[model samples]
Target: MTSTFLGMPTTAPRGVGHLRGDQSFPAAARRALADSQLRRNLGHATATIRAKSAAVIAEAPDWQQLRDAGAAIKADVMARLPELLEQLEAAVTAAGGTVHWAADAVEANRIVTELVAATGSDRVIKVKSMATQEIGLNEALEAAGITPVETDLAELIVQLGDDRPSHILVPAIHRNRAEIREIFLREMPGVDPALTDDPVALAAAARRYLRQTFLHTPVAVSGANFAVAETGTLVVVESEGNGRMCLTLPETLITVMGVEKVVPTWRDLEVFLQLLPRASTGERMNPYTSMWTGVSPGDGPQQVHLVLLDNGRSAVLADEVGRQALHCIRCSACLNVCPVYERTGGHAYGSVYPGPIGAVLSPQLTGVEENASLPYASSLCGACYDACPVKINIPELLVHLRAAHVTAQRRPTTESIAMAAAAYTMDHPALYAAAQRAARLTRLAGRRGRGLPPPLSGWTIGRDLPQPPPQTFREWWAER
Candidate 1:
């Protein structure tokens, strides 16, 4: 497949407290354990990427500078988005392409559906796009009586399997060869009853299934990684030729993109194109990168429509501290490198995006006051920051969210009591030393008795609390 994701057309609330904030992320994580193949597949796939990415990144001397540049560029764009988007709309209109602005997922889907309906076609081929998935565009089109055929291989797998994407980049990361083989056997027609688990064979099976969709479907839907404002151009990079095929073959093309995707100039595309492929897929250059500015006179998609969707992005832009989360290029490098995300996988986070990015991005876009647990889902290992091509400070955002969570609720009983005692102990060193000395003497007492008193139960309950040295470190330092 050309794309890493075959995301389920997400079907939850478009509001702040959708499926995510209303329920804790753990219930979903627990349900995911029922699939043993998913566990095995995720473990094998992520481990390989983690090792390979680390090796390649370690060898690069200018990687940190590249990350800094990417971050700075994104920050500049976010700060200037209102102006850039205006410039983009003007350029697109002048170039004879119509632009549509959508306030949220509902509006975006409606705009796309209406545009397709105008074409008088009930079926369209699609390039795998997370924006469309986030807005549930396929289902909206389906409800409107339009059948959207997925052209990307992984997306085809997910569509046929009726599964939720488990990874941001590799949506079907949780499923292995045998499972894919099973999916193809059940959904795909004219499959040799003797399909092997080999990677090449699996890819060939998908290629054969999607060949007709590419040739026949007239209208196409896509999402962009970056949209150059200066020229009103849209760009998509991928490993396979499927995206290229979808872009050129269709009579009418509709591209839905986030407002944050705009850059000031075409020169900026070069920088991201350099950083994204390597950070995302460990590749020096992608096999196919398709770029189009509105439409040409006689070539490829005589009618082009661009949907600019802002589903909570404007609210996210309002927060200074959390706004950096938008700088992510959707490179799965962070998820691959994050120890916690590696163990839990993407589905555990219960959002279109999952992992460190999801932990902060979902909450900020959806509002963190309600999604209190998602921020705490991380171990704060800082691996995501280290791996981020755009240098988002994920750990710092986590700490900020943690503080916000604490302030939202009236402090828990045990936490309040424990912290108060800690405050009292730290305020008076002499008294603290005396208390410690008394507690240390308990080991000898415990030799004769069971354990310490109720106040000490919290510390001593889990394992043996070590006896203090003859004197405290402070006293020893003073003597020295």
Candidate 2:
């Protein structure tokens, strides 16, 4: 974890879009915690997901082994990413697919916008894509006068409400069925006024709304779950069949994938196919697992393009310890199990990615300075590590990012000064004893029920300061 990225830019480039939040994590979390409805919605949804995940996970005799294999494959991919990417590009080109490389969000958006423009299609159907969200593709397309219709059920909810996604897998997890019913009533065109909050009714309503768009949309945009270098294939796994429609019905398919999504072979891809579904949706397998290798003649999309997005990932990979954050398959098991995330919700983290993985990954992607508060968002309970299908050591990554943040500080803060003072006093026996005696005076403040003053008050605000004992261990030992 101590290893550094030599001759690499540790900081992400300015203006990485949705990666940076408007406010700090603490500030945002404070507001989110006060929202009773948000807490209730998140708590219920996460609890249900956790129960299902655990139930299915227990059915596997070799679940831990699967996790290990997934982790090892990711490690191998990271190590050989450059070579595999080149091989993938060559294979894809051979299969009649074009490849474009994007270094950051701005370039990525421009690439996609221009590609969409070239097709003479003013509207495109979309699968649920984190990469597209990270780059703000919908907004970009809108700006270019192209309408991007989100086909995923959850994504459709988010788009209709004009709300940012709060969860990775379930984008609208914060919305209860009642809230979703309202969104549809308000936003959906030609919707029935009597739609109830039932899941089946809601899904049917959404399906009806998207059916015409799916059949007519000439272009589609997507994100890959895994991309195979050996066969030039891209995979997308989803519970709903919306992704299947987007992949098949469109004349042109443009997939925006993070560089980390590339696997060395279809064999390596096999490990994650097993791991992702069970960990993510708590299902034995995804209902719709769609894959495409370039273009097929008179079958599916006639034109295929894959945009390999770097967007600070090169800097992330250069860091030895922080790079494992790339191993995430977006299962979101960590979010469901995270106590902090359960209460504060995904909006608090200020990224498309929320919860434990987001806490570590967002800051690293945008640089420690941009999202510094995120590293401290975790309680280090290690639940996220246990829940991760890829076995990403998220707790360990949090600590590493924290140390990186502290070391990058240009000036000493009050906490740093206080810690330094405490260290100096502890190094000397006489001074330590004197400090202990002095600390006893805090019992007076304790009796008054008033917390510490100024900068120290920050600590006391969230926690109780224990009153000093009447005598020290040394003093008691001497008396005995």
Best by the TM-score measure: 2
Checking candidate 1 for backbone clashes, the offending pairs are: 4-169
C-alpha TM-scores of all predictions:
0.86, 0.96
Q: What lDDT does candidate 2 reach at residue 27? A: 91
Those runs of model 2 whose alpha carbons end farther than 4 Å from true positions after fitting are: 1-11, 444-450, 467-470
lDDT for model 1 comes to 0.80
Off by over 4 Å in 1: 1-23, 30-36, 55-61, 410-417, 428-480
- Per-residue lDDT tens digits of candidate 1, residues 121-196? 8998888887887777888899999999877777878888998776777788877888889998898888878989
Query: What total of clashing residue pairs does each candidate reach?
Result: 1, 0
Q: Tens-digit lDDT track for model 2 on 168-257?
A: 999999999999999999999989899999999999999899899999989999999999999998899988899999899989999999
RMSD (CA, angstroms), candidate 1 = 6.8
